[model samples]
Target: MACISSDSSDLYDVLAGRPRLTGLALAPSDDRLIASVQVINGEGNAFVPGLWEVDPAGEWEARRVTRSLQGEYAPAFAPDGRLMFLSSRENTDPFTRTSSDSTGPGLWSLPEYGEAERIVHHPSGISAFTVAHGAGTVAYTASVLPGAADTAAHAEFREKRESAKITAVLYDSGPTRFGGADLGPAEPHTFVLRPDGTQADVGGQGVVGGGDLALSPDGTLVAYTRAVAGSDPDVNANVVVVADAATGEVRRIFSRPGHHYHRLVFTADGRSLVSQRQRELTYDTPWRVTLVAFDPASGAETDLLPDFDNWPWPGSPVVSPVPGDATVWFTGDERGHCPVFRRGPDGTVTRLTSSGAYSSLCVALDGTTLFALRSTIDSPPDVVRLDAAAPDQQPVTLWAPADPGPLPGTLTEVHTTADDGFPLRAWPVLPRDASAERPAPLVVLPHGGPQMSWSGWTFGFGPWPFAARGYAVLLPDPALSTGYGQRMQERGLGQYGGRPYRDIMMLADATQTRDDIDATRTGLAGHSYGGYIANRAATLTDRFKAIVTYGGQWNLESFQAETDLHAHARRIFGDPLTQRQRYETDSPHLDVRKAMTPMLVVHGGKDYRVPVGQALGLFNDLQRHEVPVKFLYFPDESHSVGAPNHVRILYETVLNFLDHHVLGQEWHRPQLL
Candidate 1:
């Protein structure tokens, strides 16, 4: 809760220098919290995630536990109190890990107070794993070649393919790539690792894997979310499968026609599990996710807070660690506030955190103490303690590794009436010197998700760099963004660029009323879905002096057909072929001639979600129209441009672009370019 001086390093350096707290886990026996801290290595190309421990009660200072150059993630404690996590550090288990060094992630553990050891190694590596709450048994997912019986067979095939100099993957259907990563020749399957370090296949031979996984209290069962491919290869639904650990017997226990069930966790009774659900098969419409419970054996079902919509998280709901309390704690973004809400045994949901955004939640074994990485619009993530029994108490900060000096600027929220007769809200971050005489140039930033909202601010979102440079950044959450409740999000279903832009413009109009804001020199910027609006801003309105689009889609027709987000495209834009007129009208690439504003297009070449082609099309059209434009492309990046050097350059380039196009300052090229 304390800020330091920016004596040696400016706010941008502090913002870019902060290590990311990727995940957190609590030791079942004590209040020891292990956080996965990731930072770009010296090369600024690889992320190195290591384990760091903090005592929430402030019994000891935060300390690093593991130092893996390749990165360690998903920190969890074994029932015996040892810290277990997945790591890609150079594996010494030559028999299982064929790679000589720095191979894929394998299961590793550190004793309660001892050195790190390789507990489970697989040639294909592990994607996700969970240790039982009451036993040392661990369940995980690893990729395997299509017909391969297990990891051994998959390894054999891999060896044969390498020896034969063959490298080709034939995919029948489904997404072969994600954000900026590849899903290749092999498919993910489940496996279980015992305390003795022995491993075996889960669900026998046919079980294919998906994303997140959870285990039962006694370690007798494993619940995982798997994509059940349907008749159309591109059409798939998430089905939660519950499997017996001892016999490899698995059953498709939980699924719905229009819903996707994932992030499965078994309740204390072990008969039922709680997980998140997506209402539809679209891009972010699914993010309006709700909580669902099911009795795997009886097919009985329950949907928690059936009326409450807005999937506050991208994945997983934290159920109370108590043995018998039917309580689940989840966060939701409402208006400008993102708070943690607790669901009690009677299904009554109550807001816990009075304000600030909460993420990476961990509950103590006794269920009385709660720990999470909390943040506000101006402050970075810090360890905070929350009371499980008190719903209205303010979260108390416990630890912050990067606690430096005071923030160079301040952040505040405001709301206005939208043209739709509803409240529209935004967070306007202004520098310390912002005033009427030297009003800050406003940058209107629309959040992604289309379902996502700017409930709280983080430096990671590229705002601090601008704010430190004296620009006022306005992050607005239109009706479509999640956290605003289900009704608001549902209203944005078919109108991707329509109502959202109106909401953004209406908010911009409100900012004009502030004497400390230069509304005339205002710029428009967004990433992902927000990028889509930025592109639209170029074609639809000259209200913005300049526009910046980061990995935004341009051609909805092709976006619907070629992108991995076919479901999102199909849902938001409908069938491109049948709705040809709608596609033509909505696709900004088709109306590039209307654009008069100078623009900056940033994209990740490896971004599979919103491919670089989207940016390329927009950039090409602007070039043809003789519109002042610039493009910053990172081939090694994904939907989000990560990596330290890349991030530094991103901040520099964006600030420079605003200077050149909006502030009438000379543009200077970044050195990295």
Candidate 2:
């Protein structure tokens, strides 16, 4: 292993030089595992996440699977042990494959011991795909231009329009954009790739967007989630349906109001389907969610863990779909630890792993071994293997080819009792040399997604470089954080200003009492929803010497009007016309006159989630009020940034802000600005 420099510059160098592991895949035989590593291509300045074979036997051996300069990802093992994935590589000969010459993702395949070959090219890019466990059938989702019968026809139409220099998107009254969409000019559809390399239409024109699709064990049927056509996708609910793979016959199996379904996975028996269902019973109910199993033939749905007190995470199913194995596995965010659990078919839920966050769960065909990507608050995710039958025993770390170098500091969690009597779990990172005799400055950093928690082991987000710069960082989970029960979320919904704000302040106040933390030199910072709280904190109190907000919103009224998923505004704050008071009360824009501490506002120009206008408008208001503030803008970035140099600049800019204000160091501006 190469030794890493202990200096804080190492943190900056890695953030700017490293590729991130996006996903993981396990062979059916459980002999090997592969992962998708996304790194920035320097020549193009674009993220190119490619597949790599990962060894979990501790040899730390790794081999690159695909060498396409254009990149490949989403690896899956075929029934015959071949690898299949999606690629957007440009074709060498434009005349032979004119359709693939365009900028669209195409399906590619590689035998166990041969070079990869292009299977079929979709005029539009393929988003997600699944391979049948038993029959080896393949199903995938793609975008199709409206009124086009096939990919070639759409390609011709697209070329004609582009040649004529047309750039208008005519629309009706439906939503112009959805929360989870590929942001293409065409509607999404699902198709079955035939064994002979042909294409079979599954959704055709009936489907408007490509939703979650799962193939049955025998490859006879597919269950997928899609919204009803001719409805507003932003506000409409998505339902699940089963379709005959060969006949294209579809059956609507599940639908409910105020509930949206995805992750449509079929059990090994093929008689039932399982989904991570989100049940938002009311507009402000937070979310009462659980895993549900539905008998497609009987049209009966059963809640897997109806009495389970915690949220089971609504994205991907943690349980491995093993034939005759009725146990469901998942991890829930409790107090501070996000623990893994195994639920018996009889509804008995048991804890599997004791602490830390887990992801990319994969189990063997017979359910004997479990592999996942695990991480903690002070570290990023890495490959790990655990006992499938009984995971209470500590898991083993897999061999990693590349090193993440060394951490800049140490992380520790502290508890503080909120005014409501419920204890708050907050993580504080201290510098390596800090002690009672030489206290370090403190920075309160809240995470984004008030609905999200701060339990995982991610090294990049915060504190790493900050602590290395002789500053202490604190991350706290308030009432609205998920994985805790629905009751805790309800207490935070419209009650943001009072509880969430006070809860964060309480944690910072407690840290001040510690002899290792300096009480006078304190800073506050947050991104997204956390940034919203940071904005409110600046106006509500001057306890911190400096504050920073990235991709945050200050005015709920205007934020709701411009946000992509505008309906959430009504769900969280009710109608701006009716519950007018709630929307205005906590908004930092309305209370900017009270702000005194110095602030730094940063935003991505392409952000549609919170909208870039929120930052520009707030920056204007702060400037109008003569508040000490600076706005850092990224023109080519989105809500989240992946470009290596952009990420490095973000960290550098943030650290410089705190260095001058909190540490009283000379302000060093990032050269990229």
Could you say which candidate leads in lDDT? 1
Q: Tens digit of lDDT per residue, candidate 1, span 305-363?
A: 78665443433678877777889887777666678888898988888877887888888
**For residues 57-84, what per-residue lDDT tens digits would candidate 2 score against the true structure?**
6576678888877899888888778888
Worst 10-residue lDDT window, candidate 1: 1-10
Whole-model lDDT, model 1: 0.76
The deviation in Å at residue 449 for candidate 1 is 1.3
The C-alpha RMSD of each candidate to the native structure, in angstroms, is: 2.7, 2.4
Candidate 2 has which clashing residue pairs, if any? 376-456, 376-457, 377-456, 377-457, 379-457
Q: Runs in model 2 with CA error above 4 Å? A: 1-7, 56-60, 92-96, 178-184, 204-211, 229-236, 312-315, 318-321
TM-score of each: 0.94, 0.95
Candidate 2 vs. true structure, TM-score? 0.95
Question: Relative to the unseen true structure, what is the C-alpha lDDT of residue 442 in candidate 1, on a scale of 0 to 100?
Answer: 90
